[model samples]
Structure formats: structure tokens, C-alpha cells
Target chain A: MIKQFPIQQFLDENGKILNKDIRSQITTELVKNFYQHCVRIRTFDRKAISLQRQGRIGTYAPFEGQEAAQVGSALALQQDDWLFPTYRDHGAAMTFGHSLRNILLFWNGRNEGCIPPEGKKIFPPAIPIATQIPHAAGAAYAEKRKGTKNAAIVYFGDGATSEGDFHEGINFASVMKAPVVLFNQNNGYAISVPINKQMSSQTIAQKALAYDIPGVRIDGNDIFVVYFETLKALERARQGQGPTLIEAVTWRYGAHTTADDPSKYRDQTESQQRRHTMDPLLRIEHFMKNEGMYDEHWINEIEEAAQAEIDLAVQEMEEFPVANPADIFDHVFAEPTWGIQKQKEEYLRLLEVNP
Target chain B: MMNTVIQTKTLTLVQAINEAMDTMLKENEQVILLGEDIGKNGGVFRATDGLQEKYGEDRVLDTPLSEAGFVGAAIGMAVNGFRPVVEIQFLGFIYPAYEQIMTHASRLRMRTMGYYTVPMVIRAPYGAGVRAPEIHCDSTEAIFTHMPGIKVVCPSNPYDAKGLLIAAIEDPDPVLFLEPMRSYRSVRDEVPDGKYIVEIGKGNRLIEGEDVTLISWGAMVPVALKAAEQMKVRGIHCDVLDLRTLYPLDHELIAESVQKTGRTVIVHEAHATGGVGNDIVSIINDTSFLFQKAPVERVTGFDTPVPYFGFEDHYLPTPKRVVHAIEKVMKY
Candidate 1:
């Protein structure tokens, strides 16, 4: 049983090549671009966490240790393909061309953060787990119906697999041959609920078997495997072969969210230990060095570029205008209903009187 | 001299919904339908019959059992410049997608400073009259009404259903269109063949009377109409106001009706406590309390979980209950 489900990996934690058949696919250009995006998103994630700590932004869900899962998968997508992301997948969103300032504004409790850049097929981060799955299927189905080659990819966590929406999305995509990729980051916990307590299945990939969809497990820490496999899955989707479930076994180096305390449930030391052995960025560095392609000048340039970009986004986000309280009621419907109008008036009146 | 004649055809509430979706799908390439068994099965009640066949599978999509997933996805599609008409199998099953509707679909536009609009409609068969399973027959308009984002629409007849549904699909914001399952195939009227849209947030006057005003929606609208007919024979003429849209209520119409009759009786199929009836009662009290000839009376379903199929008719508000309340208001 274990033989059939052996984890597919292109690179190992020791910076050694594990799968020679796909080694040639890792061109120097591909490695550099992958490294740049992964590093850029990691910097963005750190800045977001700091902003939350300073109370500059509202509560944020950090995706630190899962950078390879986000960066690799996002890098594989064409600009026209659709992306359905979760609250914690902003790292992926940013890599896929979402605005950093708007993302910051979103965490600052500003509604503007939910807006995607012009013409980008990126959805606002869904807070409800597994809800985006069916939406992805529907969109992919729509694309297939329109005779478009574009496919859709949705990101969810380990905990989301238990949701009825997950099963529904995969089943529909499978039967309808919708062009979609069901990407799951097995981060081991949903808030404080461990994977063991959440479900009886050995892995999230196995759940795809029930839907008769192809499932693959991969070393999420290996960026090379992640990028190549995601490309293949997306290609299969565009070919009208239906959906694929790719379980990127990964971990969350930080708390589930800024408001959460992971120390309450698990050992911080264990997380620290994993950081030393399986850090995605370090693993890539090790691979590049072993391949004699590592350059200190290039790495320094990438860091400086990422930091500058993040700094500029922070300035833009900070310079944005203050949010109007009445905005809360304005967009509920295209035309605010009479009830909403009445409520908005009452709220404004209350604000005036109080002021 | 020339003679002109008008032609008409009768259709059920569900038939009106089907016609509305059919018309919209035909006219707009952006408008699409997605829900469990809504395609080949034409919905559990067949409200979406012939849609998939006519529009092809692209416009009318049969989604999986993931209410949250499909509903959320529809929001995504809507934001990405498509008008998605999604169906939640039943009212009670909508809870799983509540967060998405309230958080993302409802707030996306405002959050983005109007950069994005969720032009999506979530259609579900609601209210407790057909007495399905425990979760199958809940009336959850109040829960949605309390949410800041999203428009809640509940139509009472074939005419209103066809028009309101078109309006919902065309609206720029997310809408929750609640269909009364009990009246799906029970009510009928002639629906226009061409494109038409009912203005959301408006009410329609079903009857004009002087003694009292009865305000209701969905299944209770028919009940209120029946009660008004009975009250007329008893020398108590009652005005009936059908609240086509529950969220953005036609308060002007409601207030005007209450002032004219000087007495108000609110009727609904939802449970009494905190239902849409309560909201109407409060509105009347706030705006036209002085016009009241008597305290506003509410005739609503008991504050209990909608009972089993065997006892559903008893639990739901009936024409007799509305008439009783109207008589009491008149006597008072």
C-alpha cells in the first residue's frame, strides 16, 4: 500500500537530486525565477506579520513555512488562469500579481484589500475553508463550456478536506471534466486541531481517490518538485483531462494566525527543529550550491529587490485614505435596498449625534 | 373602429422562476446557473427544467453538493466579470456558505472601494410549508437580513417570481432569492415572454381596504390575500401589502398602508421570534405608531423548529390565522 503512495520528489532535503528523470527540467533560468518569487513572498509574509504585531493591520493568517507550496504553485500559472485563494494564501496571491498594498489594506480591515488588480482572475481570499473549491469547479466548468484553454486552481489547507464542499468540488470537477487543480497544503493543523484529530484518512491526497481523481503527494519543501508537478497538473487540466489533487506536505512555522498561540498546543522547539532540516529556502540554496550555480551577488540582489518592493508597498498602503464607516452598508447590493438605506441613514445619524 | 384582445397563460411560482432564468440565460451570455442537480435534473422541483438543454451545459452548470464551495465560487466568478446565478438546494443548507456570502461576497466591493462587485444571485427554496426534513424547510431570511451585505428577495407569485429573479440576476450586488417550496407548483399566473425586471426593494399592493393592513411575503402572501378576502365579507376591509424584497423592504408602501388602515397585522411563515414579521412590526412602530388604530398584531409560525411533514401545515401560518389577527385588530 505504501509503495503505491511513495512521496514523489525531484530534490531532497540534503540538496541531492532524487529524481534524475526530471533533473533537466530545472534550468538555470527556472531556478533563479523560482528563487526570486519564493524569496519575495517570504519577505512579504514577514512584513505582514510585523504589521499585524504593530497593530497597523488587523488580524492576519501567516503562511511562513509553506512558502514553497505557494510560490511554486503560483509561478506555474499563466496570467489568464484563475486563482481561488484562502485567507492564508496571500503569499500565493502576491506572487500571482495581486497588489501588495491592497493586500495590506485588506488586513487593515479595509474592504479595498479584497480587490484584485485590473483584469487579473484572482478572487478575494475566502475565509470559510473549502468554500472556494466548488467555485473553482464551476469556473473551470464555465471555461470548458466556453471552449477556453484556461484552467482554474484553488488553494486550501489540510482541515478544509473534511468540509462537504471539498468533496463536492472534486466530485463535480472529476465527472464534468472541468479544468481545475485542487491544491492542498497539508500544514498539519487547522487552528489547534491536529490532522490526526481532524480526520481518519492517512493523507488528504487519498481523499481524491474516492472521487476517482488522480492524487499526488509531494515533498512541498522541494521547490523544484512543486513547480514542475504543478505545471504538469495545469497542463493536464487545460487538455480537458479533468481536475487533479496535489497534496503538498508542508508545515506552518508560525501560529495559525496573529491572534493564535501555537505554544498552547504544540512544542515550539519541534517547529524550530524542522526549520533547520527542511527550510524550503535553505534547501534551494543548498541545491544551487551543490550544482555550483550559487552566487552571493545574485542572492544579495534578490533580497534587496524584495525588500525595496515591500517597502514601497507599505508606503502606498499607509498613504491610502481613511475608510468611511458608511462604506460598510454601501456595497451589500448593487443598489442598496430600502432597509439598508434606512439602516445607513440611522447609523449616520447616530454618528452625528454622538460626535 | 378596431378591437383589441389580451392573451394570458397561467403558470406556477416555480414555472415563473424557470421562465425568468430561461429568459435571462437566453438574453445574457454573462448570466449562468450552478447548483446541485440544477442541470440535468432541472432542480429537485424541476424549476430549472430545459435550461441546460437550451443554454447548453456552460450557461446552466450542475454543481456538486458543496453549497459553500459553489456559492463562494459564484462570488469569484461574479467578481471576475460574470453574473452567476447559483442555487442552494434548500434554505437550511445555506449555513455552510454563510461566511462566504457575508464575508467575501457581501464585503468584497466595499472592501475594495467599489473596485469589485459580486454580481451573483443565490436562489434557494425556503420557508416551512411542504414539511421536508428538519433542515430542509427553515425560513432564514431574518438571518440574511441581519447581515450587512447581500440583498434578500422573497417573491410571492408567478408574476413577482419571474420579474424579481430577473432583477436579482441583473443586480450588481449579491442577492439571496428565497423561493417558497410549498407554492412552487401550487400558484400560477400569466408571465410575460419578453425580458422584464422587477425593481428590488419595492412592495406591491394586492388589495385595497380601510380597516387594517396585512403585510407578508412568500407563502404568507397568499395567506394574507385569502384573509383579506374573508375579512371583506365581515365588513372589515383589509389592505394586503406583499413585501417582495425582505431586506430592502418597501417601507414607504408599508407605512402608507398602515396609515391608511390605521391598523397593522404582520404575517409570515417564519418563526415568530425575530422573524421578518418582527422587523416589519418594529418599522411600523418606529415610523407610524401614532397612525395606529390598534397595536400591531403579528401572526407568525410558532417559535419552534419547523415540525415534521405530518404537522407542518399546523405549524405554518395559515389564512385562518391571518384572518383571526385581522379581526382582532379591527375589533381593537
Candidate 2:
């Protein structure tokens, strides 16, 4: 049966709740928090792009259009759960307690960017596509073995579905009943290749069926759907049911990274139209206004706070010590191999000669 | 009677591996064994036999045939505080998991700047001469030796296998533990019981001589020894060093041996082009240049894919080849 996975939603684009059951759970404070986080990460993402263009940082992967999927799913994880993010998922990482300074430093090409805060089981953003899928599964299996209540969530893109790791991770996790959630953002393109050109499979969620697990399709632009669905999936994991694959149908409104232009492959006007109709931030704003929870003064305060926070993080990142070339050799092993030591010395000699 | 008490036990290479894993599982709660058919099937070669029953399914996992998944998963488990020993069934089959091993597992420590260190072991049965067919007999330990973070290890005998596997598990870095499939059943030696470690970067000198140095590892070790024995009969005393760990290299041991002998012959079953032999030759050229009485010679397989069964004998390095290499080196 090739029945379509109905695109599940909890709020319309205009901000009215489509589900009555969630109305009680939705509070003004929760709405305010969601708006603030969305704005905060959006601010971080835009500032990062500007930094890249100004040569302040390395190439940046922006998530301006995928904030709800990042923030909502991150908000669903428990304090002790594991989060495995990709190069494009730092918005999710920040929402999950990752340091803004460290995230900035990561884009600056420092190894210090990979370190997670104490007690936060956040893996470094995997640059290799789909590699973190199995890692998240494995981490979840460790928690299950320890008989802990912890779970894991792995974030990937639409293109990652075509990777061998996606199947391997999902299949293994399914067979082992690992306590993990496979969260996929269907952002439509991998660098330049569209999803249709990449894989024949119509939906990322449908691939989960092959592994015999629950597959969900949600409006990633709608915060409530993303948050509630991820929580439901995670609850299944902690109860030993197994992993759930969530296909967050979303879009990226900018270039894949600061180095490329989106207009080369797709029409700019189409993107602008999509942004007006499907932007996650605008969708939330619509909902806040509909619920009469939207306060202009409070909203102004949030934008200002986000700007100040991002500015401080930029300062902190810039003030960090310059990356020592020796740390690269030193940390290659727990103890440097003799070969590494010799290479380090040779490098130093070469530098001295050049200088 | 007390003086006559038997302590050392003779076991095969596979038996030594099983016992070492059993000991680790018993001693440390974090040690886990995972691979295809390792659980109910006790592994394709029975190296992990009865471990699933003894340690339970939680510790001994029977993974699917996906190498990338399980290997990457093992890296994660290691990062999350579990010491996972993963098996790739065959060394040839490990290619599918190479990205996980090379890009992620090897770089985790360096990329995280030591905030995260991967403490894991990837066990693969390598080398040829057992006639196991194509895609099953790869002796490419040199590939891993080229990597910076991973410790490349190969044990030629039961004693070394057990000790090296323990050391590999205890090591804070990722280790590529290559087992000699040819010696798995053929080579039996007296192995000590309980926990022991053969340090990852030290070379073992099997025999000492003043004439020439014979360096080898894995299945080539016995061939080197036999050649040395033959040289001894011809009154050409030779020193032999088994390079247990190839990457960090026992450069000191290799240098000392080459210095004393003033000549050297490196033997291996892998193709000659970019093998570990070249690295050793360069080191000898650098350190023992003044001590050399003859040019270095290498007895290695041809620079080609390992041929199928009938031509396999000609494809692998032989004691004859090693002896020939020694003769050629001495003549130089």
C-alpha cells in the first residue's frame, strides 16, 4: 500500500490552532518562549552569515527557514537526553543548551567548537552526511543498556535519506529497539541536487516503514506539531517501544552556505513566495496574534535581547586564543605517537626557516 | 611439586582471542562485543563463541550485516562511556565502514581537541594463504598505519594475540586490530592466562644476530623466522623483529637492530608499492645510514590485487623469498 503520509499539522499558517486538545497545553508564557527562541536563533543565524561575508568567520550553513523544526524538536528532548546534530543543525543545538560562543567558534574552524558543555551529551556537528544517525542510535542503546530514562535524537536533511548510514542506523536501531528519534528536515535540496533527483523515495518518513517503526510527517513550519510529535516519539523511545522517524517538511530560504547562491538552481521569486507563505517565524507570529498573546512591547524587548546576546557571543568567540597548530598533532591521540612528535618538530622547523 | 606446577597453557590463536575477550567482559562491565553472526552463530569463525551466552545479549550483540552502522554505533558507544570491540568479519569487508573509521572515529579526539576521545577497537581478520576465496583475504594493515589517530596492530601468535587485544582494549585511542587468518589455526603457542598487555608501539625481537635484520609482522613473521633459520644454517646470523604495532613503529628497536646488523630485509604479505616496508626503509636510511653495510631489501607480494586460489601461493611472500631478500641485501 503506497498510501501517502498525510502532512500532519496543529496550526494553520494564519496562526489558529487546528487541534482543540492542544489548546489547554498552549499557554501565553509558552507562546512567548517559543517566539523568543525562534527570534534568538534566527538572529544568531543571520549574524553568522554576515560574519562569514565579512570574513570574520568561516563558511556558515544558515537555518533561517527551519527554526521551528529545530527549536520545537529540541524543546521536546529531556535534560539528560542525547542530541546528535549536523553542520546545519546548530539552531537546534543552541536551543538544546549549546553555547553560542562555541557554535561561533566551530564555524571559525577551531576544535574547541566541538566540546559540549558538562553533562550535555551533544556530539559535534557531523560534517559527513548521515554518519551521526548510527552514532545517535548507538548512544541510545547505551542508555537503554544502563536502564536509564535517557533517549537520543538525531538530526539530518532530506538528502541524508539516500545515504547508506540512514538505512543502517534505522535498521539496527529498529532491530535493537534503541531509544532514539530520527528527525529529518526535508529542506528540499542537498547543496544543489533536489530531493526528487537524489532519491526515488517520495518521503523520508516512509523509509522508516522498511525498519518497522512509526513514521511521521509534520508541518515543520508549525511549532506545535513539531514539538508535540517529537515528544510523542521520544515518549515511545523511553518506554522501550523503539525509534521513530519524523519527516519535518520545511524549506531553506537562503543559499546552502555563504559560499553558494540559491538563485543558480532555483528561482529567487519562488523562494520569496515560499518565505511569505511558509516561514516558521511568521507562522508562529500568526498564531501569537490569533491567541491575543502577541504584545508589541514584549516582542520589541525580545529582538533587542537576541541582538545583544548574539553580539556578546561574537565578542567572546573573537577574544579566544588563536588556534595552535600543535594542538592538532597533540590531540590526534591520547598520547602523541612518535611519528606525530617528529612531524610536529619538522613542522616547527619549517615554520622557523620560513619566518 | 610446587616448583613443577604448570602455569602456562598452550592455546590456539582463536582460543586466545576468546579467552581474552572473556576476561575483559568479566573484569570490566563496559566491554562489549558486536558483529555479524557473533551472537547466536558465535561469529563466522567462532572466535566469539559462547560469549553471548556468558555475557548476555546486552554485552554480546549480533549486529546486522551493515558494517557502517555497527562501526559508527560502536564509535558512539565509546564516546558515551562504553568500550566496544567491533568485528568486521573480514578485512576486505571493512571498506564499507572506512568512512566511519577514518573520518569520524579517528578524528573525534583531534576534532574535539581531546574533549571527546574514542576508546574503541575494530577487529578484522586479515592476510591470506588459507584459500578463503576472494574478498576475504586482504592484508592491508599499512592503510590503517598511515592514519594518525588509530593504532594499527597485528598479532602473529596466540600469546601476542591475547596480550595485544587486551592492550588494544585498554588503549585510550582507537585501534585497528588485524588478526592473521592463516595463523588462527596453524600457529599455537603457550599463552599466559588473565589480563596482560603488549604495549602498542613496542617491537618484539624474536632472534638476535649481528649479520642482518629481518623485520616482519602478522603471517610474515613465521616466514621471516624460517628464513633466518635457513640463513643461520648458511652461517649468516640474522636478527629478527616482529613489528606488532606498525604505526608508531618501534623505530628505536628497528634502528638498534639495523645498526648492529648493518643490513636489513623487510617481509610482508601486502603489495609492495606503499606497504609498511617503505616506511621502515626510510627510517633506517635516516638513523642507521652510517651503519649500513648493504642496501635494504623487501620480500613483499606483487603490486596487484591478491589473485584467486590457484595463484595465491605465488602471490604471498614465502620463506624462500625472505631468504632471497636476505641474500640480495647481504650481497649489496
Candidate 3:
């Protein structure tokens, strides 16, 4: 049953374009867009991990090896579409026009980090697994009812499939014909619990059969495949044909989060070997070289520009306004209830007396 | 009631809720009704009776029996410019969606720093009486009250039901609207027609007196009122307070009433352990402790799960128990 959804790929391990049909469709501008975003997000992820190590930011979730999956799916979204990302999907959010400073602020343990830029339809990173699935469905349903072409894309890990909300959200979307794409990035493990330990199902894509939605599996390391498949899914959603489940099988070369230790559960050597054979960035660079579009200085300029932008974001994040303790009581509701007001007043009085 | 000639109708608590939802649905195009059996079936309690037919399937949705799914989806709809009112068949059945409520719906506003507000309501018929089976009559509003972001509103009568439901639907945050199952059709009041808000976070003093302060809400409000009537006959005037909103309990009313009486008896059907009544005691201690002439007494259900209907009467707080607590506080 799992073999029914064989891993689809446009670029193989050697960066050869296997799909001749999409050859002409892949323009120089399109490949460059993918390449730039992948590099930019990868730079952001690595800098974030380093910040965490330096105690400049709190624990960070890195998408080092999964850059292609995040960049591809995020680039496929329209400007008006909604994006529901998990805590690890900040890379995707950054790719979708979320502010890099705010993303860094979030890692720095500031509430202001949660706020998306003005008019951006990106939701705060959902910390809980699978809970955002139904939220995305509901958002898509709302857009569908309003007679808009806008759709929603929700990203989750492979372990999220075992949750009841995942099934419920997909079932509801299927029944309602909601314009949503359940983007599953199967990164092999949920912390230390590998995919097989979490579910008996061989493939996350196969779970779509239960909800009666079209499910496809793709090589997540291949940026071309991830981009086109997500675009196809989004197009289907916009056409009112209902949701499609796309499983981008990928790997994370780092710990689940800064607090986790991947070395304790999985072989570190395997992750090191995957970098050479199936790195998302290496695959893209391989394709660029094979297409004779790999300019060494141009690529160096992209890397340098990405680093400079990330450094500025880090500085801005550090210089962000100091958090006011009163804000804890203020945002609990639109207007503070009496109890909250009284508590805040008493605390403020205490602060004044003590200070 | 509005001063202008707004029509009034005698309605049961359930009917008042139906009217409230009807009014909101009619007035606001963004008001959406979704829950299991809510559309054609009009809800298990018929609180949403005839709404689907009047509105369309899109407006009044009959959702799958996934509490977490629908509630979470409602939160999404709420953030996306829709005011969703979700009905959980019973309060006990809401545990499946408790994570969504606690982690998402309640915290979304604070988590997003006010960029998004979940203006949604979760209406669950709670409390024991009328012989509901296990887990069907749980009155566990305390679990929600402990959380800060969500407002917990419970109305004891039809008038407050309609007004508070309207207020909750209009409020710019998530509200857990608890409707006592026992009071659903057992009591009737002249519910004012048209739109009105009873005001969240305010307590209503039903029967004012100079004696003991009787604090209660939801199904227990009737029990407290009955006990107050008995005390009145015994030459002890009582102050009966219905705390419409549990999260932000009416501090001023409670302080004023407790200060005047110098004695208090908090009544509720939920378990005595960690119940809202304990919060009332804390409020009295905080604001009116110097005025207190006696230790506060609490009349509540035993710290046990609500029993089956056959044994439910013994498990619920009664007027007799409340009277005993009142007498104990008075004597103390």
C-alpha cells in the first residue's frame, strides 16, 4: 500500500532533472527564487542555533537539513493565502514574508516576537502538535465561504499524523471541501521517537486515503519537486476541488530543538553521511552546476547578503524594546477584566514601593 | 429590558438561548453556529432549535462529533472575522477539546500579543439533576476559571441566559458559556426581546438583605435563592448574589455584601475541592476579612464524581445543605 505512493522526484541524488516535461517550465528566475530562499532560510536557521548556544536567544528549532521543504512550500503560497506553521516551521514563515527580527525576538523569549508584520496572514508558530491542522481548515473554509480564491497551507511533522486532530482536521476538510493543503514534512522522528515507533503506517501520505484526499509523496531534498507539487496542491484548492495531502519526506541533521540531543537516539554518522549524498542545498547546487547556471561569485554574493541580513536582524532583535511586565495582564483579553485590572494595579503598586 | 417598547416573551432558559442565538445570527452575518446535531437536529438540548432552517447550512453548521476539531476550527473562524458559538453536548464531553480551549482558544490573544482575538463561545450544558449518567452532568467550571484568558459565564435563569449569551458572542475573547442542564427547561422568565447585554464580570444581587451573604451561580443559584427564602421566613434576611461571570468574580458586590453581612455561605454544585466557592472565600478574606464576624461556610457537593441519575439527588447541593451552612456561619 505504501509503495502506491512512491517518492516522486524531479531532481535525483546526482541533481539530474528526471522530469523532462517540467524542463521548459523551470525558468532561470524560478530556480533563482528557490535557490535564494533556501539559502536565506538556511542561513537564518544556522544563526539561530548559534544564538541559542551563545545564550543570546532561547532554545531554537533548526531546519538545517529541511530548508528545501520549507522554502518550496512557502514560495508556493499566494500573498493573500494563510500559512499555519508549527514551532519548527519559522523558516517557512520567514520565507512567507514574516519579519526576521520578530522571528529572532520569538527565539529571544519576547511576546512581541509572536506578532506578524502588518497585514501578513501568518499565524504564530503553533507549539502543540497537530492542533493547527483544524485551524488551517477553518481558515480555508472561511475564505471559501467569502468567495475568495485564498487558500491555507498547514505544515506538520510525520509524528503529527498519529494525533486525533490530524485525522479530524483532514476529515472535516475533505467533507467540507475546504481549500487547504495538509503539508506533511516527514522528518523521520518526533524528538527521539522515530516514525515507525509512532505509527504502524508505512508512509504518512498513505493516511490520506482514509480522508479520501489525493495524497502524494516527494523527495523533500529536491527543491524543484517540493515547489511544483505544493503549487499543484494550492491550485487544486483554489479550483474548489478540496484538499490534497503532500508528504515531503525529509531529514533534520540537527537536534529536534536546542533542548534535545539527537546523538542519544540516532546515529550521528548517518546524519553526517546524508549531508554529502542528499543535502537539500547540495542537491540545488548540483542542479545549478549541471544546468551551467552555477556562478561561484554570484552564489557567494547570495550567501554574503543572507549573512548580512541575518546579522542585522539579530542586532535589531537584541535592541528590541525591553518587555514591560504590565503587558502580561494587558493582552489576556481585549479589555482587562476587573480581576486582572486589580491584580495589575496591586502588582504595579508593589513594584513602585519596592523600586 | 430596554426602556423603549421592546417586546418581551416568557421563555425557558433553553428557549432564551435559542432566541439569543437567533438574534445574533440574524443581526450579524459573521455569527456562525456549529456543533454536533446543531443544524437539523437543533442540538441535543434543543437550545439551537430551528436555527438551521431559519439560517442556512453554511451559517448553522452540523459538525462531526469531533470536539477538538470543531472547537479548534471555531477558534480559526473567530480569528478570521467570524463569531462562532460551539455547543458541547455536555460539559463532561468537553475534556476531549480541553487542550484546544486551554492551549489555543484561551491563549491565542495573549500569545499573539492581541493581533488576533478568538471571539468565540463554547456553550456546554453543565451540572447535575434530571438524572444524567456519569460524565454527563459534570459541573467543572473551576478547571476553566483557573485559566486567565477565557471568561467563564454561567447563567441561572432565562433572562440572564439571553443577555449573557449575547454579551459573550459580542465580547472580543473566548468565553466558556456554561448552561446548567437542570435549569434548561425547568424555569422560565420574561426574557426581553431585542439585543441586550447583562455585562460580564458583574454579579447581580437577586435578594438584598442585612444578614448572611449567599454567593452562588449557575444551577446552584436557584438552590441559594431557595435557601435565602427559607432564611427570610426564619427572620434572617439574606443577600443572594448570582455571580454571572466566574473568572472575574464580582469583587465589589462580594466585598460590599460580605462587609454588610459579616457572614458568608458560598453554594455550588461542583465539588468542594478547588471549586469556585473557594475563590469566593478567598475574595471575602481579601476584601472583607476585617468586617467578617464569623468564619465563612461553604455548601457544595462532595468531592466525588457526579453519580448516576438515581443517586444524583444525594450528590447535588441542596437548599437544605445551604441553609445548614448559613446557620453554621450565623452561629459562628
Model 3 chain A lDDT-worst window of ten: A25-34
| Chain B only, TM-score of each candidate | 0.96, 0.97, 0.98
lDDT of 2 at B205: 94
lDDT of 1 by residue, B163-209 (tens): 99999998888889999988898888887776778999899998888
Clashing pairs in 1: A111-B111, A111-B112, A112-B111, A112-B112, A135-B73, B11-B188, B11-B189
lDDT of 2 by residue, A1-355 (tens): 1367888889988887898999999988887788789999999999999999899999999988999999999999999999999999999999999999999999999889989888888999999999999999999999998999899999999999889999999988999999999999998999899988988877778887788899999999999999999999999999999999999999998999998998899887977998889988898888878777778998899999999999999999999999777887899998888888999999989989995
Which candidate leads the pack in DockQ? Answer: 2
Tens digit of per-residue lDDT, candidate 3, span B256-279: 999999999988889999999899
Considering the two chains of model 1, state its CAPRI-style docking category.
medium
Please give the lDDT score for candidate 1.
0.86
Shift in Å, residue B29, candidate 3: 0.4
Interface DockQ of candidate 3: 0.81
TM-score for every candidate vs. truth? 0.93, 0.98, 0.99
Residue B314 in model 2: lDDT: 95
lDDT of 3 by residue, A48-104 (tens): 999999999998998888999999999999999999999999989999999999999
Q: Which structure among the candidates has the greatest lDDT?
A: 3
lDDT of 1 by residue, A68-167 (tens): 9899999999999999899999989999999999899888887788888998888778787787887788778778877899999999999999887788
DockQ-based CAPRI category assigned to the predicted complex of candidate 3: high
